[model samples]
Target: MDSKIPQIIRKSFIKEIIKKHSNIKVQSGVIDLLSECTTVSVSYISTICNAICNRKGKKAIGDEEVIEVLSKMDNEFILNMFEELRK
Candidate 1:
């Protein structure tokens, strides 16, 4: 969403999600999942990133915020589990 967040990072995030959740195939679903997990509206996510990039000149969501959101959804552990699954 953030214009400064390179397309590659967004793509990578989507790819990682798909790789971790094989059953989630739709891009929209991925968006929904992110929204649900973060308790942030998908539109807000898009808007916030855009604002941050355009107005504040930030590249991506800060790691601390990212970690906090992931922690709320217990997704940090899932990411670790996925790492094991990958191996």
Candidate 2:
């Protein structure tokens, strides 16, 4: 997350957690997942989310789609999860 999380870790998380979850095929869920996880930083989350949504960094054309999805996901489950944690 800093300037040094290493590409390997990013790839692993994307492949393991982000990609494996079928419902997460929804673009915004990826952002919610990354943000709620905490140990990773938002900058790192953004990179991973973008990579996953774009599909291996080849589909830059979907950038707008990705933004729309992120806006929807950021509030739904992510805020709920944080509230539960606070309790």
Candidate 3:
């Protein structure tokens, strides 16, 4: 991950996805799709705040954990839902 990737930008990206989808049922599919495109996981996304703040490596995160975190932050549930679709 590049240090240049700003937190606000990441948050905005998530917000945009949520705005477009807004459905929790869609997370699994979205995640799968994303997995095919990148090495990011549900745990990475779920702990995004902590990872960003501490600059954690991608290898340390897991997909299921990210899903769990997303579940709690439904304010942008679509971002989480997209996780499943990624596959």
Candidate 4:
């Protein structure tokens, strides 16, 4: 897997999300840190999804696998999903 994160999850996107959620002024260094952290987190999640696929004898990771991994990793993830669904 490439160490380079996708453009979709770049610093600008992180800034946008943070801007939407909080009113505090975020420094460039903080945005950069968040971007890097997001990249690492996505990579880790992908790794877990891939491992689940391997265990299930599947060649591709699907939404179900990713959801399962997320649910196991964080209950808040499932709560967030429910919140979105409610919205």
lDDT of each: 0.57, 0.57, 0.55, 0.80
**Top candidate, metric lDDT:** 4
Q: What lDDT tens digits, residue by residue, belong to model 1 across residues 8-68?
A: 4655676786779787566766655664554444455455555555565677765444444
What does candidate 3's lDDT look like per residue over 1-87, in tens digits? Answer: 675465445545655677687864446456445544343553456457466435654455555445546666674666545665777
- Mark the regions of model 4 whose C-alpha exceeds 4 Å error after superposition: 1-9, 82-87
Error of 4 at 85 (Å): 6.1
Q: How well is each residue in 1-87 modelled by candidate 2, as lDDT tens digits?
A: 665454446545665775566554546555556545654555555676676767755655354544444455675665555556657
Greater-lDDT candidate between 1 and 4: 4
lDDT of candidate 4 over 42-83, digit per residue (tens): 798899999989999999987777677778888686658755
The per-prediction CA RMSD against the true structure, in angstroms, equals 8.9, 13.7, 12.1, 3.7
Enumerate residue pairs that collide in model 4. none
Q: What global local distance difference test value does model 3 have?
A: 0.55
